[model samples]
Target chain A: MATTNDYLKGTKSVLPILTGLFPFGLIYGVSAVTSGIPKVQAIAMSFVVFAGAAQISIVNSFSSGISIITAVAIAGLINLRMAMYGASIADSIRSDRLLTRIFSSFLLTDQVYAVSITEKGKNMNTNIFKFYIGAALPIWLTWQAATIIGVFAGKTLPSWLSLEFAVPLTFLALLGPFLVKSHFAVSALTAGIVMVLTRNVPYNAGFFIAVLSGITAGFLIKNRKGDR
Target chain B: MNTSHLWAVIILSGIATFIIRFFFIQIKQAPLSGKVKELFSFIPPAVLSALVFGSVFENGLSSLTPRNPYLWASILAGITAVTSKNVLLTISTGMIFIWGWNYLY
Candidate 1:
């Protein structure tokens, strides 16, 4: 059973990931502003879209003169990975009501999913749904605030500060923990190589290719080990 | 971008994202097969690596060279993260190294 403390615990568990995400939010806000997106639209993008990578992609599309439909399509494609996340975590949240599921799905970004799944493994006795909400709300609120702050601070920040590096740095922090096992290490290396190889591919198709091939390699390697 | 176009992109993309996230949750009857289970287990690592590589190597294949501070900083950050498992340490170390590299060269 989940007590109020469990919910608070969930919020606490998410803090580490949120710390890494803080810079990412700032960069996204700065990107939106510098990319010539209107301030209101950029802030609204955070409220409405709520996904960092996709929001960046949208801003890139705008600056590059890509059509609005194509921009939206790219955003949709970028977020297709969230479906994989939903599929993987479906069982953990199967007990949630439709309304809870509907609302919570809106909060299913990469960071939140990673922490919540980790928490689920560590504490199976807690209410996963309530715990998820407790974690999600803080991240949602922080991201929105960070974007607004970035919009205001974007112009003044120096170029050499290299705040953009924080995005990849945050991913490194998340990726490091996943290297606990050999197959996971293999997956990360293979995916990273594939992503680099296909970097010239347009419209983020390389991302999809890298993810698909990496997962395939990991699966095959795991099965090969199992058979041995 | 105009206001209507901006709103359209935001709302449409938002709806698409919501649908993707909600689709599998609504369909709970089918259990994942063994192969699918293995595949899903790798998604987190695979997806994150893809994202990190994409950013760290912003110039694509050319970024593997010695000139890129991002490459070196990421290497350092990865080591710190794997060893310490601390978020702040990883980001701060990476940022500090990049800032120093930029300052020096």
Candidate 2:
């Protein structure tokens, strides 16, 4: 049976991620509304696409009068990391049922993936899939609600708050725990350097470049550390 | 965009996203060398860092100068992240700093 400590621990892990996600939800709602997408369509996309970055990309591209094909392409490219995330969780869960696997795939996101991986590594006996769902479902629901709130009330909210910064802040919080080690530190630095160097690449392809470069750097550092 | 075009975008994005996800999962059978595994591990931090920097900075084309309070706030946030090991504190402090700076300046 789950004890009070278990509940407390779960709440501790889940709340921060939800808080971080709140700003992005608000941004999506406001942006979608401002971009001329009907409220229902905007709300629907949040559930259907179920990705913050892709939704933002779609809205931004549409607002700029870019072709839908190009917009979708850009959004897809931005969210390619979800594939890695899905695969990572799939390996961990190792569920035989295809339906369970497919349903679980819908819950994969950056925050969910990071939290799940860390939790899986920490708790060997715990049910990894359940933990992932526990972490992910709240995030997904919170995102939808936040978007709707933003859509309806974003304009009424003061500009002084500048809810846009909330996304970066959330990511900062998510990434904070992972940087406890040197390998992670160097890798993050390398990624930042590469991203800055390739920042001008069109369609945000630079994000991919930064990810690849950082991964390569991290591998090298880890190997060198292992050798020592 | 028109309705047909929007549907096309959604369809294309869904397909592309599925393919990218499937690519990683399909590779589970392949044996990764130790060195390669080590290298791939860095991808998350590197990719995330780059994206973070890109988000904080404007125009994606400019160099990092300390002209903006956002950068200052981020530095403070980074420091807080390293010291306290608390995500909430780091983010809240960073946001407050940025908000206050924007308010004052």
Number of the top-ranking candidate, with DockQ as the measure: 1
> What are the Cα lDDT values of the candidates?
0.80, 0.69
Candidate 1 scores a C-alpha RMSD against the true structure in Å of: 4.2
Per-residue lDDT over A44-158 for candidate 1, one digit per residue giving the tens place of the 0 to 100 score: 9898889987787677666655567767876776677787778877777765578877888888888778877888888878777767778888999889998999888887778
Give each candidate's fraction of reference contacts reproduced. Answer: 0.76, 0.53
Question: TM-scores for all candidates?
Answer: 0.75, 0.69
Residue-wise C-alpha lDDT for candidate 1, range B9-70, written one tens digit per residue: 88898888889888887787545576665666787788778878887887789999999888
Candidate 2 residues lying further than 4 Å off, grouped into runs, are A1-42, A52-97, A109-139, A201-205, B1-13, B16-39, B59-63, B84-88
Best by TM-score: 1
Residue A185 C-alpha lDDT in model 2: 82
